[model samples]
Target: MRRHRYAKIVATVGPATNTPEMLKALFLAGVDTFRLNFSHGVQADHAKVHASIRALEKEVGRPIGILQDLQGPKIRVGTVRDGRLDLTSGERVRFVLEGSEGGKDAIPLHHPEIFAAVVPGQDLLIDDGRVRVRVVGVEAAVIEAEVITAGVISNRKGVNLPGTLLDLSPLTEKDRADLAFGLELGVDWVALSFVQKPSDVIEARGLIGDKAGIMTKVEKPQALDRIEDIIRLSDAVMVARGDLGVEIPHEDVPARQKELIRACRLAVKPVIVATQMLDSMVNAPAPTRAEASDVATAIYDGADAVMLSAESATGRYPVEAVSMMDRIIRSVEGHKLYHSIIAALEPGEEETPPHAVATATATLAEAIHATAIVAYTESGTTAARVARKRPAVPILALTPNVDTSRRLSLLWGAHSVRTDDVDSYEEMTAKACHHAQEEGFAKPNDIVVTAAGIPFHTTGNTNNIRLIQI
Candidate 1:
């Protein structure tokens, strides 16, 4: 079931391909992972998909990764009385805080937080910037605005006040409940969207408690500001280019995507490049040449996985999209520059503690001709560090938390196993050997490299390293 490849494909499940037979076809079509987007599907919908995926895993006799993407705090306007309204350019519009009957001149906006954040001369974009408005004045019960662009505003249209530091956390009560449901469903990975800082990852980790892997979606400017810390804290990362492109300048996204991919590769965490990989396939049976180039660039940039959004979820050609992405990845990987780019982008020895150890361990593993490298990790930090090296041998990461195991599936060359945390170095080595044998990763007298923290109790305290013959 395991393929000796560096890149993987993640396909989204939606109305177009929700049946067990369809899921099985997707799995057989070369999808390495499945993404269940909480933004669109309900619990019942997801349960069906999960059941189908599980059944397919058994029937195919291979481990298929499942990622449940939680819908983060999505800021939108409340219910519109008429369901739709037209705003003309330069028209003065009053957005009332109360839910009373208001005419076209005055519309009701329920969120007071947005009202408080609204200042004089702040641009407000609606429905991904189809319509624009400028705040003229702010009162206790309303926000007075003048329409800068004319468009039809519908019910619950998404509002984006970019660069206006709203006094709000990214995660809402809905996201918390969704996270709980995803964990209960035994999902392999849980992707938290609209993450702003490292604390978001910490809070999500505390709530999930290792039940599923936590992958933060780097979509905001604030997230990019704290990229290194966020990567260090999160189990894995997803380059969620959809909102990210909208949040930041479009030109910056390409460079930012490369930067994030390189950072995750160096950190050894699996990084997924997502959104619109084959957007045209939603209607067209094939992707545009530019879309094909976009996917190839992700693989050349050393991404662990390339994702399909609407292409697989609601597209008319769902299976074709997945199959195309798989073909593109394989084709790009065959080029000489692919390995060269990966090797050239490899992180050198740094002054940091974890980085230093990871670099040295990777070098040692290659030098000793080790069959496998076993990393006993509590916070999953050491495993990521090893992955950054991109060593030729497989990295078997033994963790006490099941969530950590699932999350590591995205990382390059990492195979995760759930086990009890070791109190001593000897136990760590013995268990590493035991799991290696059980997984058929190693045999008697096979050389294996082991790394773990010396204290063993503290999280992210990785330091110790050793070479052993299993």
Candidate 2:
């Protein structure tokens, strides 16, 4: 089923929504993409989920994208003998390099990069900042710290150093293995987590090549420092606010989210605002009023998609959450305020051919009152370029590549459908008009602006634009 809404929904798959029937319901409800979180499940479990998604895609006749999220450099404390311990404020603690018992006084933290990179006065956040510590002394094999925020410390709790940039590889051995498995499963997108710099994207692009789209998770504070370069290197970006909120001040998240979304729009890259959009719905039947506003705000900011984490992964009301998010996005898009906000945003530079043509397409559609803007794309670049202009009319992207169509589902205002390849301008124009009408985007005698490369099946060769009447 096609959704009338411009923004898309990304749902995480877990035990709650892993069945084919449940996946189909989610897709029908408005989930354009499925995220396979590698942090929780094994390769075998994820393989099953991937299989169910493919089955549902065929059954539903929709291009559903599968995003494989790699858990990158997750630093955690070693196992504790007592299972958990409480630390009081100002209590001295030692983190050692060797694997040993984790007690109230001393714990094992074997990540060499953390030990080497962190210095005195750096703050350490453990268990998502439930407990905090300040490094007072540092040694090659150990670090001495005093607890700042006292709380229960559990075994293998995560560690976050907000004050220092660890000299660590973005990918771990586990991530490498997971990436290979996801590639084998034919995932459409791969989201690299904890990206620190542009080099991280370059490294992942080397591994992914053209097999899948590489999406960088902008989580770390350091990552924001080099966001421009990283955005240039990666195929897409996820405004992962969960870890980011932990790493930086909570009040700064809103502005940062807006900046990230705006930057992605100007760059003509698909961006998703993720983490806890409907978190309360994980347990409750309905979301908080605040959650509804949050989703709407993302749409107003021009984010291509808003994601759900535990709310869909293992939530009690996965389908309901998707439905609610869909309604919120549609409601916001129907408002004059949303349109005004989108119109006010600064677009990309129009000097380039793609940007100029895309801007012209949007202008022509509005000027001529065209029914829709149809783009024939092999790599989805043409569709993205048009989407970046934030046109008032709906966009129909026809592609022969299933992967391209699926990935386009996450782009704002682009309704992607799989179709046969068209070799000539005449064939492309005819197909565009036929699909626009068949897809209910237009009717007979309606006008549409079609854009594509003349040499069909060639990537990044969008050089033709035509106004066709069906």
Best by the TM-score measure:
2
Over 312-416, each residue of candidate 2 has an lDDT whose tens digit, in order, gives 999999999999999999999999788789988765565888778878888899889998999988999999998898888999999999889989988999999
Error of 1 at 354 (Å): 5.3
List the candidate 1 regions with Cα displacement exceeding 4 Å: 100-103, 347-354, 364-382, 392-405, 415-470
Provide the lowest-lDDT 10-residue window in model 1.
402-411
Question: Candidate 1: what lDDT?
Answer: 0.82
List TM-scores for all candidates, in order.
Answer: 0.84, 0.98
Candidate 1 local lDDT, 160-186, one digit each (tens)? 776666666667888888877878889
Local distance difference test values of all predictions, in order: 0.82, 0.90
